[model samples]
Target chain A: MGKYYKTTPWVIPELPQSLKNIFKKNGKKISIRKNQVISGNDETALFSNTEKLIYIDSGLLGQAYKTYCVNKPYAMSIVLPGRMVNYLHYLEIDNSGDIILALRKSDIFTMTKSQFDGITEKDLKDEMVRYCKKAVTSDFDAMCCMFTCDTPQRLAYFLKALAESFYDDISTMPLVEIPLKLSYAEMSYIMHTTIRTIERLLPKWRSMGYISTRRNSLIIYK
Target chain B: MGKYYKTTPWVIPELPQSLKNIFKKNGKKISIRKNQVISGNDETALFSNTEKLIYIDSGLLGQAYKTYCVNKPYAMSIVLPGRMVNYLHYLEIDNSGDIILALRKSDIFTMTKSQFDGITEKDLKDEMVRYCKKAVTSDFDAMCCMFTCDTPQRLAYFLKALAESFYDDISTMPLVEIPLKLSYAEMSYIMHTTIRTIERLLPKWRSMGYISTRRNSLIIYK
Candidate 1:
């Protein structure tokens, strides 16, 4: 396995008093084990209350997917830390049946929708809107990449996106290490390709000195 | 062309006073020709002012896409009337170079972000959030369909979605007519399949009585 190392947690510079108050009043921080189902299953809806949001405080990777059969499911998108999860449920959007899965150990905070609405600061709301937009736009970009880019390019793009999510200052990072454990099948599913395709391309990428396999993680050189 | 016909527009049951005031203040309704570019490109940003939102009042079809080269572009999502467009830009989401195209003639209304914010009513903001969530979830569902479903099933799903966008009560409509002109190449691009695949499957779908071609439009039976 890749060496397990603790990285410094990302910190928000400042929060408006209104938002801080919401977090203080309604937020409940919870720790999730790797490969845990954060939300969405027969047992529980993503937001059982439908009036709350799950804020990812720290994590490397997460996934949202829909289960068709008990054994067959398709991943929709990879989730990153520092973004609100299940905001859609709070908004009362019909997801058409989807669930959130934690790809790694993660820290998340849950707060009620009423608490979120109490924050009247425009800047804070604007920032939340920006994050939502980024989440949607990133999903759109991933779809675009799947359709337009070649397999190799698509893989590279996915890696770069994952790396960017972890480190905001991507330029200074010489090597981007994805701390999550991803099997070939999982990678294939996320990239919309077959495991065979991933196996074929990884060797070529390794030969090109673009990426290296370290235990369960993939390391991309900058 | 499929018989050109007019349909009654969908009506919002009630609007909050704050929302109504926003519509009165910043809303400007404009008519666009068929195949118009509503946002993005050198001519337009998704939202020229991060402080504006586009509300699709009446339209059959619209498309949001990203252009990579002169000839290579990826269709991001299909736009439907009665939904808000460019809401993402108002939230300050970078679309990473995506543009919106009207697949058919459309009527749209534009409003300023400040005007939108003036609507302090929780219900109004909740409604907006619901729309945003639906937009993102729909895109994610499309991605899932593209990855897991077969081409014919995928095409059927797309057609059903398009039809649902037009008719709110889809079950009541015996025949769902898609007024948009989509060549096989366009369908291929949107479905992430080859033109040959679309051509091959379309005839099969026609023979199976799932859909019928009327000029360039598709008429699907319920």
Candidate 2:
């Protein structure tokens, strides 16, 4: 029988020193628990830190899957009962320990309404598996492999790639400042934890100066 | 002399009653700060909100401006630092104070990086006036009418419209969830505020039972 090593359920001091430096400079701190999503596709990454690691404390991310069918690479979730689907689509899986549910594009209509209705983060992941199983399996495998490395190291690699994917060039005089759209609560879901639990750890980071808070946004400095 | 009112800076409330109801039922909350951006054309919203509002704290908006000699909308002031410029060529000024700064359609070489880099939100609005002076007297005058509403009212209106724009089929879904794509910090720049402020307010709403958190999205009670 293959030994199944469960993902740990603690907030490891895996954040990079560079990020800590920046966070301290900006007057913030860093600490992540399980069931917390650090980043996602189709959104501007927080702090532009490219070290990617799915910070999980207490939920089965492997079991939480979501999928979407878009006219283009558009996000398909919304916060209210409205007509437009924001581009919160695209999930990155990289661990056997992390849950990876399958999803199909054709089933968008079947799941979209429910997704909009108030599906739990776990349910969302389950629906995603039903929608895009093929695309995620590989990522899921990678996630499991990556988790073997210290959490911070894996996170560092993941974050750097994420930053490269979304960083916009400086030449264009962009009149509007586009922001990363996910909230701390939703992020907590991806990481598989409670909002209170996630919120609880933030102050620790703030005290350590590994992160900085500006109104609603948290700037990661590494 | 025309009475010039500098737009007062109003931070968007982290939770509204409507948002609270939705989050309580759905377990998610998606919000935008005053003067912060929700999304852009082709770029997708950072996060999906059941409804979205551009928190206009205090500043002129909707004055047509020129970058590469083309008239464009002026709203949030932000630009990515690399890669080819996307639909940023024209600015879309909505009547409800929602502005989409186009980047996909703009030319990459229109302005040198230094010129673009140094431009601030104030500078962006000023350019609009300079660009439209031939038909418009000043940037301030053209944008003043739309920028005069209180931040809460403006936010309310934007949320209503955003709801209609994304989810209108009320029969099926009980709550609305918006997929988000932005980080908290990026949102601050768009809203003309800081992340600390945002952090302080979100929990207030959660305590008031106005909003809830999800793993990768926000749920709003309709």
> What is every candidate's C-alpha DockQ against the true complex, given to 2 decimals?
0.28, 0.01
Per-residue alpha-carbon lDDT of candidate 1 for residues B140-180, written as tens digits (9 for 90 to 100):
56655655567776677677766765565677777988776
Give the CA lDDT, 0 to 100, for residue B111 in model 1. Answer: 77
Once fitted onto the true fold, the runs of candidate 2 whose alpha carbons sit more than 4 angstroms away are A1-222, B1-146, B149-162, B169-174
For residues B85-150, could you state the per-residue lDDT of candidate 2 as single tens digits? 111221111112223332222211233223332443565444432322211111222122223233
Candidate maximizing DockQ: 1
Candidate No. with top lDDT? 1
In order, the candidates keep a fraction of the true contacts of 0.31, 0.00
Give the range where candidate 1 chain B is weakest over 10 consecutive residues by summed lDDT.
B1-10
Candidate 1 DockQ vs. native:
0.28
lDDT of 1 by residue, A26-134 (tens): 6898887877766764364444425457776677344455524233455546655656666455435454355676667887777766667675466776666544444
